[model samples]
Target: MNDKRKKLFLLDIDGTVALGSELLPGAADFLQTVKENGGIFCFLTNNSSKAASDYVEQFRDWGIE
Candidate 1:
């Protein structure tokens, strides 16, 4: 593996970040640590009923970026 290579983490929202409106423990810390270690991440969801902005708002509500 290339240690210099940048990493990208595609994280799921439901059950991963939260179980409804609540943010799971260590979720924010994990993401922040990844960022501090020079990693990038994005939130993914299977539900297409809501737009991307909706997810952004949800994250904001959870105090996640």
Candidate 2:
């Protein structure tokens, strides 16, 4: 695999980083670690109930993205 180039980690919420209305353990830490290491993040949520702005607001509330 080409691990030379930087990677962009696409993480999903609603269980991966959160559950319904609650945050998951270690999720923020993991995201920070990767971000600090120069990795890109693109949050992907399966719940189509909300728009991209909604997701961004959620992350902002968590002080994450």
Candidate 3:
């Protein structure tokens, strides 16, 4: 989140950014804001129970997909 510099936001989709079947408050807005402003983001997770696609679906359900 620097001015005109290379930046990236890495997000964890489990309890850090989401709770059981629910998205954390401001999580969507935070992502959307970064996307809308041309900021970069990468979702990095080490979930043994799921993968990136799983997060994709979950984020979609939370309106941040």
Using lDDT as the measure, the top candidate is 1
Cα lDDT tens digits, model 3, 1-65, are 45865468887767677776788888778878888888878776676787667777877777765
* TM-score of decoy 1: 0.82
lDDT of 2 by residue, 2-65 (tens): 5785668887877788987577989889888888898887877668899888878878898886
Q: Relative to the unseen true structure, what is the C-alpha lDDT of residue 42 in candidate 3, on a scale of 0 to 100? A: 77
User: Candidate 1 — what's its lDDT?
Assistant: 0.86
- Candidate 2 lDDT for residue 20: 71
Best by TM-score: 1
RMSD (CA, Å), each prediction = 2.2, 2.6, 3.0
lDDT, residue 35, candidate 1: 89
Residue 54 deviation, candidate 3, in Å? 2.1
lDDT of 1 by residue, 1-21 (tens): 559766899889899978777
TM-score of each: 0.82, 0.80, 0.73
Q: What 10-residue stretch in candidate 1 is worst by lDDT?
A: 1-10
Give Cα-based local distance difference scores for all models: 0.86, 0.81, 0.75
Which residue pairs show collisions in model 1?
none
The reply for model 3, stretches above 4 Å from the true place, is 1-6
Lowest-sum lDDT 10-residue window in model 2: 1-10
Candidate 2 lDDT score at position 6: 61
